[model samples]
Target: MTETTHNTVTDERADLLETLAKHRQFLRFTTQDLTDEQAGQRTTASELCLGGLIKHVTSTERNWANFIEKGTSVMPDFASMTEEDFARRADDFRMLPGDTLEAVLAEYAEVARRTDELVAALPDFNASHPLPKAPWFEPGARWSARRVLLHIIAETAQHAGHADIIRESLDGQKSMG
Candidate 1:
């Protein structure tokens, strides 16, 4: 390949890594102020907590990676789940019973690592992958793996914003980076 192409690739990779890093920064910022109970507390009538958001984001990363990017789905076990399921399960977002806060944090850290690995390993940002035929997304829309990564970033960002708000409401603190 030409030197120009190599430079372009490097630049692209840098931007992707930077974007992912920012997401991690926010995730850390959001959870940093919370105590164990606060982190797991449901802030609103709707089931949303800092811990829940963290769990949701991790699950989403793995879901997108496995079902969309890697083409090996694990949705069947969760196929019966719906929006309500999420709302109810939000309270259970923390690590299983007897699990420590460190364990949950480690799990999320691994999720972020896997996300980074997927992004870094993609040689071509333009390559397409099958997206679920969900109503919210365009029908039969084949998304580039790059787009999927970006979408995850965007979704996490939105939730991070919510987490920041909820965290502040729980206490006087605000701004998740």
Candidate 2:
């Protein structure tokens, strides 16, 4: 039996949200006490930075949440992206000029709040839509809102691990022991 709260989420939804929150906290903890420069600095061979990870996760969550409501129209046709499009996407992995840690974190918080509200208010987890046409996605494949939430959780957890590594490299800090 699933319990509902004032926000009206089922027990399953609450579990999903709790897991997502834990990962988000781990990711955000990696950037604590860091300056913008430090946040943006790439600490490893890969082009990932703490601030960029936060930005990328925020964008990803926003897009997926939009997909839950609007379907494939919310996603870009990755198969047809041009050089400029690719370049712009690459920017999601870097801290561009004038990008502030504070602003990035603020945006992520807003996106997260929206996603949490969306999850709470969702009428059904089984509602699904065909995936946008992309090379990586199988043809005719569809994903339910529940699946999308799981994907988001996986993405956040994966990147949080990456952020932990980057943060450890940047400084002596660890998100966990």
Candidate 3:
């Protein structure tokens, strides 16, 4: 078992947490030394920005963590989402006024902590829940808590790559040489 400050986690849980944490660090590294404007600036043709990527990943992790705990009730009804809903979702990729890089990082850190805590404390990784009704998901599909953790790790890693590209474009500073 992996010993955490608040709880002991099984080896599987520890591995999951370690992988997610590594990706989260990579994502956050891209934002280092960036001001709010720099973080929000679109470095490429895509609408994604460094700060926005962090915000998006933070939101995604939080939602998925909630799903692991509370199931589909925590997810939005994507099938019935309005244009306004989509627009609001799009805002997650932008750093609006009053958004600071510090605050965004702080929020992401807090979310990660909560997710780690939940994962460590969960008694059964095999417990499963039906996915929310969404076109992308197979009908009657179910995902175990283990699956949800894996999904969060994949999502974070993908966005970290995106953030690395954005960072390189922004200032020619690569996350790795």
lDDT string for model 2 (130-169, tens) is: 9998888999999999999999999999999999999999
| lDDT of every predicted structure (CA atoms) | 0.68, 0.94, 0.92
Q: Per-residue lDDT of 103-135 in model 3, one digit per residue for the tens? A: 999999999999998999887788899999988
Clashing pairs in 3: none
Candidate 1 wrongly placed segments (more than 4 Å): 1-9, 72-100
Q: What is the C-alpha RMSD of each candidate to the true structure, in Å?
A: 3.7, 1.5, 2.2
lDDT of 2 at 70: 96
TM-score for each of the candidates:
0.78, 0.96, 0.95
**Quick one: best lDDT, which candidate?**
2
Candidate 1 clashes between residue pairs 3 or more apart in a chain or in different chains: none
Error of 2 at 23 (Å): 0.3
Arrange candidates by lDDT, descending.
Answer: 2, 3, 1
Per-residue error for 132 in candidate 1, Å, reads: 1.7
lDDT of 1 by residue, 28-111 (tens): 687774577777776667557777677778777778766545552443334456988766665445434564555566777898
